[model samples]
Target: MQNTAFTTAWRKGVIARYLTVAGATVDLTGCGDHTYYRCTGCGHGTHGVSVIERVARERAQGHAETCRALPRPTH
Candidate 1:
């Protein structure tokens, strides 16, 4: 059995975009080089983030909830 939820980069991208639109902070880090994004009035790595689609489609929705509950930027 394989987990197909959020397993696709394209899906991740879409969710990322939604987060951006929702005014959530986004950060993509690299080994030596790093990139940082911020929301208008919020800081990075504060609150958790989620995908409505994932929650609705996942078999173990509770797992999805936990993933979204992870520490993340609040912006």
Candidate 2:
């Protein structure tokens, strides 16, 4: 399947730290106290108080890998 629009949104960072791999959507969002990752396919996510953004990014990537949903490499 082609997800050109999804990839474009990810590349542009239109929704902050959000990514869609395969049919799963990973969204990172937070308020003043905490940040969280919400995955649609997995039906669960992680969050922390004042956690670094990279941690969340890594978690999302890990989930993608486990789900075998990583995006295909572009030429």
Candidate 3:
């Protein structure tokens, strides 16, 4: 399936973000010439940067499917 969940331009270094059903986000960040994804809800994501863009994007999308973590409110 095609992933259209990524939203852009909301934060620096954030290439895209996948907002979960519970309002948590899976963020795709660009690090130098590499890329990595991190989840704000369950805190489950790739441990290190992946040079392959497709792999990283797919991983982020898949994680969003099962993650039901609600967003943490800012103080």
Candidate 4:
């Protein structure tokens, strides 16, 4: 599990990416419970799923919320 601060930051990043036209990629690598997000177009890291989950929990309790879901594949 990730710390509160880290998870919060991760959630913000994911939300931003997901809502943007720039797009972002979310990946679950190996056996890790955490999810990683990367920008496929510019090759930049976005955030992780653990972070998102943390944010979701916080929001359910009346906290504010915040992805960069990467762009589609190119042939």
Candidate 1, 1-75: lDDT as tens digits: 332223324323222322232323233221112222222223433133333433323312222223332223223
Q: Model 2: how far is 40 from its true place, Å?
A: 0.4
Give lDDT per model, in order: 0.28, 0.55, 0.73, 0.34
Ranking by TM-score: 3, 2, 4, 1
Error of 4 at 63 (Å): 21
Error of 3 at 4 (Å): 17
Among all candidates shown, the one with the greatest TM-score: 3
Q: Which pairs clash (backbone N, Cα, C closer than 3 Å) in model 2?
A: none
**Any idea how many clashes model 3 has?**
0
Candidate 3 residue 15 Cα shift, in angstroms, is 0.2
- The TM-score of candidate 3 is 0.73
* Model 4: ten consecutive residues of lowest lDDT: 59-68
* lDDT of candidate 3 at residue 26, scale 0 to 100: 90
Which has the higher TM-score value, candidate number 2 or candidate number 3?
A: 3
Backbone clash numbers for all candidates listed: 4, 0, 0, 11
Query: Model 1, stretches more than 4 Å misplaced?
Result: 1-21, 32-41, 46-75
lDDT score for residue 66 of model 3: 77
Residue 30, model 2: lDDT of 63
